[model samples]
Target chain A: MKIARHLIAAAALAAAASPAFADASTEAFVEDNANEVLESLNDPSLSRDERTALFSRYMDEFADIEAVSRFVIGKYANRFTPEEFERFQAAFKKYALAVYENELDAYRGNEVIVEGSTDRTPRDSIVDTKIPRADGQEMSVRWRVLKRNDGYQVVDVALNVNGNLIWLAIEQQAQFLSLLDRTNGSVDALINRIERMTRDVVAGRR
Target chain B: MLCFGVTDRPPYVDIYLFIEVLALKAGQAAHICCLQHTEVIMKTVVSALIALTTLTACATTQDTTDTASGVSDPFEGFNRNVYAFNEAVDKAAIEPVARGYRAVVPEPARDGVHNVLTNIRQPVVFANSMLQGNAQASADTFGRFLINSTIGVAGIFDVASTLGVTEHNEDFGQTLGVWGVEPGPFLVLPLLGPSNFRDTFGIATDRALDPLTWTEFESDPDLDDHIAVGRTVLGLIDTRARLIEPIETLRSQPEPYIALRRNYSSQREAAIRNGETEADPYQDLPDFDVYDEESAEGTGAGDQ
Candidate 1:
């Protein structure tokens, strides 16, 4: 009976401490990763090509490219066979790398300050951050981080768009799903579209 | 069993045997849960818009405190309720109609309609640009109107853009901001979305500046009324259609209210500053008209 009481007490204590731990760890994860990204961007020594490559490496390490690729397609993810899914995810990673290259370059010299964090679920957390501009203004950014067996992976980024709070993944879901819906749920169509977009970014057509 | 029919699912859903695979994964369940919480999520958006609108209405009357997002929203309670009302109306009526509009109208036709609508607003934009003494923007606005109106066939083709004249959005509110007038409290007017005290006055002035507000066609006075009402209705639908994805995506967020407030305020600030507020990653991307053909020409998968 004593052992049972001790076990219960231990379990209760662990549960009680879990959320605070999650918040702290999640905040730290974003701060470290974001600073790492900004460091590469702010590095005067690196050429544009070198910085972009470094940024791609950081995305590979910090972002769950596979999971995010899957998430963006939403329920239609099952439409792809293993080979097709692999193809799509690979193409998605390349597209994301290109998009983010342009994205991070805009913040080349800005500082990322992690404001705070909130645990939405036991495994899901959001880290709030701000990058103050040189002109006395600031931009708000939030990371939706999810915990996995390996470690934390960034699933989505939330930011303001025309006065609306939009999650990058969900926004992509809407866009991709709309295209898929129109193309009769063709994974190949999506893969091709993404590849063309990647080409455009690489070639500076957009 | 939350079984939304294939036709019934919102535009955000995949709509292709989605439910069959939905039960197979935890992630899918979470996405479904977000859809289930639509009304609750939208309440937050409503509150933010209302707060901004109320703030705008009372800018001269009340001493409003600035929120962390830099918006002064003094009447949050009243704003939230009004926002809720607006969201309910939007979901039940406006969005569905917009979706239907997207469905029946071909992409080119819709683009033409959007172009025409934008062209109609150029006179007002030009007025505000002149008010702010922005010579370049004024010239651009005037050139766009003159070119798009005649050569572009009543602004249906956006020939001005193709000619490299470009386009811009300027309003009396931004003119006030340029004059160093404060935004004064946030507000959310019912059915009009977000505003503030300065913007409310700006809205009124813009309305007065509109040629349609007072123009009486010598040929047909009744035609003028019809054109005015048609412009209002079509403009609302076009704007709503463009926003469905962004607003739907907003509902999936963890803190929609705060997100809306912060973002809305940030965007307004950016707009007031002529979009010189730090670099927006999503800015250079194409507009969120997913069904359009030329949308594929953009650099990224989505605007957001």
Candidate 2:
């Protein structure tokens, strides 16, 4: 009876180990969104404003902006009131969208090929990709996807720029930390700074 | 030996005293008092202290024997001092220059320079690949050099990559590792960061084998010096600029020294394995999927 039970357990383990049973769904999710962003950038009919709006919408759909904002705020997260936090989150999303929109505009004839996904945590997966440039140079990118109640959302994008892994969230965290330091660690100061930046982005000042 | 001699001296002295008393009596006692009492006591105390210290040192050595054997850094004390010096140089000079370079040069221009530099080093890489008996990689590297030099406009653009010839960055150090040469003692060279004894030799060999080192420019000493200095400075700036973000991240880790050491060792090991080992399972994943925006948005809205 014990032997039979052991055999059953081994069979179940083998079934789970199969490639088809791995996290293909999550990998597909990240790749699909990445391709959409690339395709939207390539669309000729869309005006700059239209393209920016479409990219923002895509970011909102795929990215957990609130989570990223809270994470970047880091240790100072507890300083904000409920209303202040909400405002900060909204402003952060706009600022992030503007930054990404500008960055993506540089993509001319690059192709994003998703390599695979690795489960970093039970609810998080890091999807790897290679962006082949027109000149034959290749860049690596990793998308950090979080499994929410509804589905997967991208929380961070890490680009291997010149062999250096530059994670967006971590970079933002450092920026926020320095900004807070410069403002005497005041949440109001940070909020005002973010608000001003968001306004500048909306006005196309930067 | 001195301590033992001191401890045994009292018995010998007593016997000598007894013989003296019988032979010379009280008349010669004053003459024999030349041996100072204070000097004898001081010698005994110093010898005793020395013996105690020797015992303590022995115990300490025994306690550290296990750790000493497990670790490979025989020159750790010297290496750490060198590491500190390198860190200071990087913070003061190298990092600031790299930052200034990044701020001044546009990304596209910087990448072009980087490509040109890499293309120039193809001959060295090809030679190492040949040494390692990797004919396919050697052919690819040679092909890349030829194509980029002609069609790619002096390698300012990587036209060879578009033609399906990817880069293989083989070096003499990696070739030596592939040939079963053990990585000798870990060393922290001043301004060079982490390296090993084997790699130090490898660097020397590679430099000697580089075709550029034996060029006709050597006949014109001034031109040779100019070329050498220019290449070194450009290469240093390019590498330091590329490493800015990664080094910052490494510095933020809890134990930067241990982190860097482990990273360097593991990366070298992986290079030697040539992606054959399953040391990193993530390297074997399939190509990424591309999704449509409408369906993704619908699902996302439903989830929220």
Candidate 3:
């Protein structure tokens, strides 16, 4: 149990402390969406609910929530029954959407610029972007863009810390797995935790 | 030993008294800047003043962009140098010993050591939790300490966690943050690595909170020193062993200093918020940096 906690923390710490590179189109995809999001956040015409609705629409269009859900569950993905996986994926999507919605609220009106990118594969790239704070300092926000048959979808957000890539999906995966470990790999337990987390986010308690 | 004939009072009382004096100094330091400016420059000036002796190791920079990554790294030149020095030391001395410790000690044994180390710190955690006005965390810490110390056989096993009283970390640094003390300038101590002005004082307060710091043995006067030293060394080895992969990953980064600075800020922010407002993706993770509670200093470890 201790090892599990440490390994997950290490993964998160490692990711937080690492950095990576991305491709051109990937960078454009992330940059355009990020700027648009900022524009929406800064627009005084839009009500809070309206902005949240737009954010949800953007997430639905830009994020591959299904692929990320499966990846986050790690080995347990194979173990879950088809029905359980479906239920888990739905719960996870709701949780992810709520989390991003809450997180995005804090970065209203911040200017996002694509610094550079590195394409690890033909279909995958890590785009490095910066959100300039009020103090003229830039906060690194790296997007992991993946090319789908339809178009490019964001799979993860890497907040570079200590030169490490703190990937959003990977961090969540550790948390999910840790919960599963404690609950003896019960799918229902994970679902419950995700649902609770989502509720917390929606209620502004998280 | 120096307190032998200086006072008829117990030696441990003198240690606590000394800590109280230092605490007074820290309070004064806190009053000077953290309470006034609530901005960057004043805090930096104060931190620089107090830590002047260690400043010789860091190259001073006049850049106004101290909070470049939204983190006040006023002494980045010094921090980077010390970071490099710590890496070299870890690579040369700590890393190899940690590797050896990992090779010799099984995972289960190491976990036992980790649990025991954590159990030992519960008192301090409990104290901070109470200070932070978190009744639940305070109760949980107390329960964990009582249960682990007894049923778990001096915390060789985490029976408290099994009983569903999960552990949470609360150091004096976090306590201070909760108390509205702004985290001052980002600092990288020679061996201690990443920290800030407010947390620096928090570290001292935490040590003062720990019973081990003031505990003494009448049968063998030197026993406390031996225990403290042994615990510090063992903790360093254990933490290094857990962080071998992560540190290597950090080394592979193009700009490690920037990465560390940004991440440290985020991590500290998350800790202070107690997982609210800031998403704590690593809440269950062990206190990688907090091993510095004693004289121990090293990076974190946990393999995937």
Candidate 4:
């Protein structure tokens, strides 16, 4: 039983630590969605409706919404009632949508090049990439879209200053959990603080 | 041996006191960031600082002999129970949902959906390695971030083979290894699933590196019906997906869970990071120049 707990933690550690793998993962989707993706990328100007449509579809297709949700819930997950948990998820999602919605908007004009992705082969797999900068020169900017059966999604990205964002996610999850544990056995307080920050930002108080 | 000196801290759990101190420092760093994922950076940087020193100091011949010759094989009895429980989870819950998903969404559609979501995660994944002090992995993560966010359309990593960059795995368990922590024993979490104290700590440590943890909090009302269930359900699916194949390669015993634990321990410790995979699809990606969108595009955009 004790060992059971240990291995569960191992599984969690494995699940938590390793980024989930995808197979034939890179090329199939890109090849299939080439036109839809190309259309989305080529049109620099998208109506708010179009962007929202893309965002919604993209969210369903690529966001790892579950992992993100689990992270948002934090340790309090063990403590929360189902209703409370639902509330927590709702709040988290709204915060994310509100945040990234604007972010996608900023990328409206820059057309993305659909660099082809390779399959999950043994020796070599391709990194399908292209720079999104409008002027398109000497900008330390590029996007790697790995494909799978569903479609394509971005794994790592350089958002201006911070280069390695995904690795940062791992670091953040590890650090935050410790703090939450050190605190009053709940991520409630942290969630409140995040909410406060989000409200302040939305209100232009940041 | 370096004991935690606190029985209350959990037994057989020998994370260096320096790490305990570093964990505290990491928490404090998170406290300071009050902005983004700097908390994770703080923990990774601090842990790396300690790991580099500790690994070197522990590199002496005698210490090396202990690690090389230690027969404890910490994971001896733990993996059996946990692997069984994880299997139970797959049989009961995950498979059905995945089967449903497969039926509802054609395979191509399923992959597309997964790709789109995975891309958004590029930023998060890139930062995860930096916390481990993996310079090259971090660089590749950065390159992946750029290519995914830009070319792949808002953060999905498709350009794997092109840039001669290969995905180097990292997680809490792996991080524990870098810090010279032993795997100790395997255990299954009640609803959560397989782990050890070290890996549990690694799990805890890895959280600090999660971008979503620092940025978006998931309290939205829309995801109510399926989003919430979908996440965990898909998580289990993903879990089953990754482990199922690997399991076949291992010698499965009557106690499958225990076997899994032992296998992971051997595989993780023995694996070393470095050496880019051959053939690069991203080789054609044009030269990159740094562009700080958060700063130039608008300050406090994220905060807003």
Candidate 5:
């Protein structure tokens, strides 16, 4: 349910941004992306290693991480110079890839059926998808994606199964945003703090 | 029985099967005991079990906040194998795809696709800025960009940037921000970009009813359907291909998903509030002002 919403949101965000391709855009992108992705999925010759590599690319083409990053980074543009910003950009992309690569790797044969997109301004949409588990259990995962360009980015993923992970991300973002809102209306302090933590982790200080 | 569909994305599979077992067991016990409101309890449990199954797949770890409290970000425990998968694609898939599109499409057409996308987003952005009380002309500027994107250049170009049309990204999630909801963990969804729990919900609300179908789908997508779809999807692929190099930076941390969620979470808000720049609190900030160094040239591109 939650993951499904994420897919829907991605579609909605794409539709909202490119009103021109709203209804059928995903059908097109999916068919196109799936066509490319499914080729490898069908090749018995391919190993999971090969399949993972293949799907990752498909996912990249499917998602514009840099663009989405810029969209999400919205304001932090000013505090850093171009160089400093790029450093953060590097950090951001690495983190994004590290986070998502597994989920893509997890895509074996399970069909994630995308249902519909939502139509409301000022809100995110729910993308519906289903997971038919092997143990005679069927469930749903909705992807809550944000639309931008003619495509969408997954901003949050919800699992109707547990509802914990999706809720966890949202609840945390809200808390962090509040911190930013309260601190001179900027993310500087929080980012600064995170950077410090990151540095420590990288340096093995933490 | 919660007959589960076998799929590729899991950890969720194990969890879902487990819930199904729990529910079935509970139902059997309920039937034997003849508990009060058996049907209602069964439905509630079933619904919750079903709902819980979905929750486990939300691959995020934790949201950004002072570590005094908050769950650790899930990405902190990333599968290194997945990292390799991400890195490989950054090299193989996008390069060829980008090369293919660049060869076939005209630059103007490509830019037109880019522009049109930006234009439509201005209003949503304008609303975001207005909500934040961060900028003054946010709404009007958004409205102007909206018109230009929809009409000017036949809706081919995103005149917003040229005219300094800034967009803000406020949404139900940000509203929840106003209410101080926590952004759960950072999650990198397959096929979806990046997000967190709260924003995930925001994503759901954002797409509840697509306004585009009503507005854009009025006419037959028409005989040029394949061509039209190809052109646009290609335009989109071109856009995605463009980001591969930059997006790879997501792997720098153990918790890429959480990092991305934080960045995007903030980015969306900043866009909507039209974060005031030292140089232009009153004037709208240009799109991708800092990143697109090439476009940053005095194109003043922001002629408006």
Candidate 6:
């Protein structure tokens, strides 16, 4: 009887099948926007500030920054007051922008191809891509898109750096948590570190 | 009844058959007891066989995938031990020096060093490309080397790339693969992490082919030895420094060994394929999901 029940459950799971292909619109959406961002970065006429602003706007438009920010904070979310959370999010955006903005020039000559996508769950999908390098190598990038009430928003970006698939949000979580731990689990300490790091980046300090 | 315990030592199926035979010869009352015993034993035997068959099927599937991937690691036990040792060495010695090198060197200077090393490698690439009968790639590689050496300021700047002389990265292992040599058992050398038997052999051959190795030290043999040592040390440091971020990312994986193995094998296979679509070794492996329960929780707590 137990075996029969197990078989039935397995069959049910197999029946509620996910489509092999990712949602076409989502794939197109990511490819189009990623190209736009790359083009903006490559544009010689655009000033540094203008390019940064463009990147920021597009990033905010496509990326679920709030979801990422909350996710990074993890259980430490309770430690932050609403204002503190808002400040941290702002700081995070600046820090993330600073890091990515510095890397814009590196992406200038690369070609981005959206290979395909896989459904992670009912709500989430992963769009796979390959960025061919100048040195005759290829890098893989995956964008995690979550379906929201509005539309699909990118919650995370993962890079196959060398061979490792590194998720941006996960990396940030580690960094943020370490800072918090160092300050005796204080959220204020992490916020300060973020703000300081953002300031340093803005000032062109390493 | 004495036979029952003895038969239990054998497989349940054998015991069930034995009980059936006994039931045929025994009285009606004894036969009824045997019948009940056989029913219970039969169910157990059938379930056990089903489980055994399932396990065998799963094992066979795994073996098929491994075979299809063309990445056989017969010395997995030894390789894993070596891998662990290499990781320890990296953490203890190699990583600190690499980190220090990165901290001290300016970005452009580091790039210059990387460019120079890459330029030096072009001759090896050209030779291998020629060996593989890829004339166009060989020409391109030779052109890049010549242009970069002369106009690119000793290859400190990649001016050849601007002039449409793109890189053709070939190596002896790839050449061997092109010539239909099989990549034998996967290996992990002491410091050099993931490689295979064919690639390991290729490394030796490539070293022999290097111009630097053939340079005559007619006078000052000690200086030559020192120079050779310095070159190897610098190369090691440069490679390690470049890999710092990737290694850290790899270490963050739930199963670093498996992840690294998959990554290395796939990357090597891709290199061998050279932009040609081939069956991906990593295709059957589970997708890397960031929000997988264990990873999500672990990453959130900074525990992994």
At residue A149, give the lDDT of candidate 2. Answer: 91
Which regions in candidate 5 have their CA more than 4 angstroms from the true location? Answer: A1-206, B1-95, B102-107, B126-138, B167-172, B216-238, B251-304
Tell me the lDDT of model 6 at A34.
76
Model 5 lDDT per residue over A1-206, tens place: 99999999998787667523334444344444534554555457877667656756766666556653453343434445667667666665544443344333244345556655433222234455565533444455555445566665454444443222222233223333344444653445656644653453333210
Q: Estimate, for each residue in B48-93, the C-alpha lDDT of model 5 and write its tens digit.
A: 3354456557645444232322333444333223334544674577
- lDDT per residue for candidate 2 within B182-258, as digits (tens), equals 87656555555665656555655566566766665646767755655556667667766766555654453323444
Candidates 4 and 6 compared by lDDT, better number? 6
RMSD of each: 19.1, 25.0, 24.0, 26.1, 25.6, 23.3
**Top model by lDDT, which number?**
1
The per-prediction i-RMS, to one decimal, reads 16.8, 29.6, 19.4, 18.4, 15.2, 22.5
DockQ-wise, the better of 1 and 6 is 6
Docking class of 1: incorrect
DockQ of 4: 0.01
TM-score of each: 0.49, 0.47, 0.49, 0.36, 0.36, 0.50
Q: Docking quality tier of candidate 6?
A: incorrect
Worst 10 residues of 4 chain B by lDDT: B295-304
Candidate 3 accuracy as TM-score: 0.49
Candidate 6 stretches with Cα past 4 Å from truth are A1-206, B1-70, B219-223, B275-304
Give the fraction of native contacts in model 3: 0.00
Each predicted complex: what DockQ?
A: 0.04, 0.04, 0.02, 0.01, 0.03, 0.05
What TM-score does chain A of model 6 get? 0.81
Model 2 misplaced stretches (Cα beyond 4 Å): A1-206, B1-71, B275-304
**Which sections of candidate 3 miss by over 4 Å?**
A1-206, B1-69, B279-304
